[model samples]
Target: MSSLHDRHRAVIPDWITLYYKDPLELTHGEGRHVWDAEGNRYLDFFGGILTTMTAHALPEVTKAIADQAARMIHSSTLYLNRPMVELAERIAALSGIPDARVFFTTSGTEANDTALLLATTYRRSNQILAMRNSYHGRSFSTVGITGNRAWSPTGLSPLQTLYVHGGVRTRGPYAQYTDERFVDACVADLEDLLGQTRAGVAALIAEPIQGVGGFTSPPDGLYAAFRRVLDRHGILWIADEVQTGWGRTGEHFWGWQAHGQAGPPDILTFAKGIGNGMSIGGVVARAEIMNCLDANSISTFGGSPVTMAAGLANLAYLLEHDLQGNARRVGGLLLERLRAVAAGVDAVREVRGRGLMIGIELTEPGTDRPAPDAASTALEAARSGGLLIGKGGGHNTTALRIAPPLSLTVAEAEEGAAILEQALGSI
Candidate 1:
């Protein structure tokens, strides 16, 4: 029989990439560790691309899923779904947006798609403002607005998207400016771009931190500054919190909170962590904007009972245990440890992030050029040392992404950091 990897390659799209030169099939997981097909245990630092919010095989989420499945697996949005309504109620109350309304989807892509539909319909325009070095989703509509050329496969788009500045703080044209000046420069650029665009631009959608673009983020209050300019033109602001939501950033519950001077965004999209490993995505917006559609829209599996239960239980566990505090405490130590490690390694360019979402950028020694090869080496080395991490960047995947479950312990963080240090040493 052919190997599972070979079988996968034969059936799956070639563009669907897998990690590692020699892939290892993960069989099961618990807490912050997972076992491979051969029963090799490894510390899971990436948390399945930051989707596992609390931990693998979390009892709360598992029981919720089981109990809900035994009752009713799914009921389309046409009927009154109690679980969906309950989850929505919790999310709305948590969301800072006034008169907030929620709509669920199966994945982040669909959530973002729904958000775009709402924004475009409410504003009556298809022109969108997106930040450079950003990755929203994989769907045609989301792809069109994505500014990262590496991920964007085509120029054809349903919406006319204009890329904005300030999503990336380290290597952009305004990188030399101080934090305050950087905000001023980016806001001025946004104003200038708005002047050049046609009237009635739909919305400006952005990630508080660019996840796929190697966890990059703008200076705090940058969006608040942009919000002032956007208000003048009546363009909506959509914060895509898919990867940075639910206290992943530690200092703030929502990534947009860092830019709270102008208040909550007009719209917000979230996914990845809320349901742990289960598929759950949603959009939250003000009532007027959410209810703007003249026609009806429903997601058959968007708010499925099982997924909602998982989300609710996962969210409860996250809050009740104060995983955000854990992320802040443990992540701070990990960040400091990694920085010290990077300081000793010449190929390591920079270590940046907050909470459990940290990134280690690799570059050619003594030069600013991205060293994707070095990143690959580090990845393999980490795996060999019984740890699993992820790699992503704007310049050909040159940064290592380290986002363990929010429940990550200090001892686990120390172990992961030590393995990462050894990996960097190998590179």
Candidate 2:
């Protein structure tokens, strides 16, 4: 093992997983590629788990951070922060909820935690409805709502969490049902669960596309159907858009837009790509829920000027370049190419996703069983071919995840796809 790898294993907790048999030490990146310490460059398909939304080493974001750092780095949430205010204004305007309020945090876990706090306080209950195969965050409360058994450790939780269905369409009991019928069944299941619960549920938190759950999703309007039920029961809906926000899906700016008929969610949580690698996370809620907490609270490192400036610049760059449109056009072509390549491969179970967020589920050759070994082999092979990808799934990490930077060019997509196809063949 390399000296650095041995040292990393000695210092970092084993639970903090690293990719590859030989853990890679990436020194820097530009555009859609990164170079390891050894000077080997690889096309980055995963984009640091979708955090590098725009591009690697984006000048706008870098300059923003540098400029802000040269001045005041932070004033905490105790004072009026200009950059924070500006960024919040942009987000509030974008949030569909009328009279929305924005709360910033350092990570998605904190954002979701704050959302849970607001929801539970507003409704006066700790009961929550969560989707099956969901992966929210790794906090005490967030993990309770995270339905993926692989991620959730210990069954104990502060709040009562009920796991719902319809997140994964092809592998569940309802896999054979038509889209409309599947949604109806999940909704009925939700209502039945509601009937069984004695206390009022605080909220229903879900990721539109299950990111760590192998990028799985129910039918387009499944959440909309759930929203209708939530309205009747006075339960709030929280969209965990950590991975699906910022037009990554191409069709919608926010993942909940796929369920637009039910209107905007009562609350929304975002992280990952918003700051383009700068640590930023937040919760957006209407006045009622946001104002529910009677006591004042503060996040010391929440809205640091440097991160806010980074977010502002990143948002501007994304909107100006219409990166969402690029994700659509380029991602569409990439998916088509990948699907064609997978057609002749038996180990590939499915190719599904939208825009830059795509997933390739692997199975034993000519069989439906999840082939995690195949996925691992393919990941190593992809890296060997100078491509970096990610793998995740509730079912033993059996899916190859391909989510490139939103600024991914057609040529880059083609290159990544070619490398991935060869990797699959090698597996």
Candidate 3:
């Protein structure tokens, strides 16, 4: 341990600067709070970017992981693993998609990659459509479908793939169309794209609630209408719920549910909340997509016994506590308080999101810059004041993203909000 400390004193990697690396070296966590190496306690409102759903060092999750590790850590997913099978069954049951098939991966990006591949391969087409301001993953194929141009530099021209109007519910480079007009325009563009291609399009991937896109949600009737268009064009609908699934959206188990859509997506991807800080993600598909998969579809380390155990434990804890209900209850309280705070501060342009996944958009007076600088400053201030937060959005990365653990107490919520309020005041 001392040798490790000495090595760390020598030099840190350049990649560490890429992210707003917090000064507090996180040593450990319990519940919604983490401790730094210096033994300072800080509230974790960000939840490791919303991955620690059940909170850090949760007893159930820790015990399960330890037990599994003690027993057997790796049993190549090629063989049967009870924990994996059981977790998959539970996920399928929770998703309410009858006869659903599950494929696991190590991260949300991997799950998304699998879903994209499955969609294109099942339909045997190269054309795919993704909404603007969307974020799927950093991989080549997934990045190709991401609409944020800044994510891929001009030199990476090959990454710039076909795109349609990202729906016009909210204003940006795309005109703000009425809900009906937005749906019609998106449908028309998709149909036109499909027609222009010699072979039919493969899939249309979208986030039920755009996570890194400032928590932007689709308009009412938009999802159903989009599904109708996809069905008409014989294209598959892939809901990228990597950030919005697992009951984070207080209204329903999945963000898509809030849209009141009747049918399920052909392929659904999930992560973030699966392992409660452990890396786990997966794609659940219906017969149409799953039937096409062969031996090559398996991920070498995807559903290993240890990860499966972690997922099972985390999910079990979530369900047992009815964490979904807690998210709704606490989220409602948090939202109300945030809205009130926004009203008090003119810098806050708007507050949006469902359940625990929420965003507070900041804007400057008479400036097109949506107060992104202020947002960054506020985040830094909040960290110094003992709270963690995240930022997202395209041109305007001014939205303060908050996704605390499901088990966060009402008082803890108030404390977190108070920290944000103080940070805003300082900014």
For model 2 the TM-score comes to 0.99
lDDT of each residue in 36-111, candidate 3, tens digit only: 7888888998888889998899998888899999999887777888988999998888775668989889888888
Candidate 1 residue pairs in backbone clash? none
Regions of model 3 farther than 4 Å from truth: 1-22, 153-160, 166-168, 173-181, 294-297
Candidate 1, overall lDDT?
0.93
- Cα lDDT, all candidates: 0.93, 0.93, 0.80
Task: State which candidate, 1 or 3, has the greater lDDT.
Answer: 1
**RMSD (Å) of each candidate, 1 decimal:** 0.8, 1.0, 2.8
Reference-based lDDT, residue 92, model 2:
92
lDDT tens digits, residues 383-426, model 1?
99999999889854379999999999989989998999899999
Error of 2 at 121 (Å): 0.6
Q: What is the full ranking by lDDT, best candidate first?
A: 2, 1, 3
Per-model TM-score on C-alpha atoms: 0.99, 0.99, 0.92
Residue 113, candidate 2: Cα error in Å is 0.9
Supply the TM-score for candidate 3: 0.92
List runs of model 2 lying over 4 Å from the truth. none
Model 2 lDDT per residue over 171-253, tens place: 88899999999999999999999999998999999999999999999989999999989999999999999999999999889
